[model samples]
Target: MSFTDSSKKSDPANPKDGSSSESEKPSNEKQPTKTRGQNKKLDRSSKPKTPLPQKMDEEDLGICIQITEKLSNSVYAFGFRSPPDPTDEDGQSYLSATESPMDFQTLLNKLNTEGYRTVNEWKNDMNLIFDNAFNYFAPKTMRYDSAIKLKDKFTDLCQMFTKSEEERWMIKIEKLCNKYISADNEQ
Candidate 1:
């Protein structure tokens, strides 16, 4: 799947039109001086609470697609590939048992739609697919065994991909930190 532009956009909250909001303007009233720690807290609090979606690069996206494809193609994947049909008896029972039901097909849809912001988000949803299965079925049951096998397979397949993603994340973080440090020094 093709990724959308990943470039950072200006935050509307901090406008670039040269007009500052009343809250942003320096007040005439003398303000209490904040300590370095307090300044850091304030800076953090001023930023958005939720992280914006970071589009996956081609290599990462390809790896994710490969993993999902493998899981979907597996014989054990039949039951876990789609959500249970609510009209059927077994489906009704599955729906009732699973609080946060996840399936491989849904994961694929999300990937296509760019619903995931990061690799971790994709991984968490994948884990949920297995976790829901594990929770719904008894330990010795065939379905449970299948879920365990699939989960193990997922873990094995993701090792190298995740390690590389982690390295990329660290590098991005370091660059951001350096940019902030330089900006602070200039100010």
Candidate 2:
């Protein structure tokens, strides 16, 4: 059934007459607009106050942990397969194993190969740098909370990567960030 506004209906005290009482006038009638502090019914100032999270600035790291839980579900929503362990230097060798002269560069080059796609192609996704780094390092078989911890670690690593801005080391960073951006324009 469709809903009707209670104010539009006549007062129950006098059923026959369709007129609303003085207290319940039709909304179309003009009522004096209450200024910020004039209304006594809803004394927003006197209401029980809760500590606002917004007051907690970027310095609040606990907020980071809270957000990572949400990011875990989001990353999974897009569908992800965890990368090989960082310690296993030879873990992702299979991507380049088919070639006769398999090496680290070949593995990095795989990102540019056909069917490979990065998060964004046309531009650098500075915003999602943390997300991508986190996904890259997180274990394949981890749950939400564990994944969050891993994400935080990766985030710190990304920060260091940015801070250590040596051009020689940045070339690979640029390549990985730019590669696999858009599937439509496979570049």
Candidate 3:
């Protein structure tokens, strides 16, 4: 059975007697061959493209800064105020559990430099900070509890921020409508 033997064995259907059977002959039809990365190319091409990030406007940038400031100032945010130190004792655990890490300082830096294009993008990073903390710390641990509190605070802050923005827009619209009506009345 060694490949290097170079000795030819008699075929099962066509034995040493030189008799051949028609059913055992090779077929003329060629079997299809598969190439590497063929399916990967199709998958990548078929995937939907994500739109590029838009630049953050003044108002959006202000909101981003304000949210980050508020979150950073919270008592529950003490642990997540800065980036995690991977060289520290708990570093390996943090690195292992959190897929993407975030911190208040990093968020603030991004906001100041207009790193995020939308409020939602900034919000996602903020959420990631708490999520990372939660993932790294055990359920009953103080750090985990802190993360829960911070997450709740962030949620409340965002809801209030959105409502205030909507209210401001509505007030502006109402004033514009009033001015239009007053101008029509004067005519």
Candidate topping TM-score? 1
Using TM-score as the yardstick, the better of models 1 and 3 is: 1
lDDT of each: 0.83, 0.39, 0.77
Clashing pairs in 3: none
lDDT of 2 by residue, 77-183 (tens): 22223333436655444223321222222222333242123222201222233344343444554433444554465455344224333663576567666675655
TM-score of each: 0.61, 0.19, 0.59
Give the range where candidate 1 is weakest over 10 consecutive residues by summed lDDT: 1-10
- Residue 47, model 2: lDDT of 78
Residue pairs in clash, model 2? 117-180, 118-180, 118-181, 120-181, 121-181
What residue pairs are clashing in model 1? none
In the order shown, the candidates' Cα RMSDs to the true structure are 16.8, 20.5, 15.0
Clashes of 2: 5
The Cα RMSD in angstroms, rounded to one decimal, for candidate 3 relative to the true structure is 15.0
Q: Model 3: per-residue lDDT, tens digit, 1-187?
A: 1113565666866555565676768789997776886555445767889865677767568767887798799888888898778888676566656677789998898888779887778888988887777656779898899999888877887774566777868866897899999999999
Please tell me which model should have the higher lDDT, number 2 or number 3: 3
Q: Model 2: runs farther than 4 Å from truth? A: 1-142, 164-187
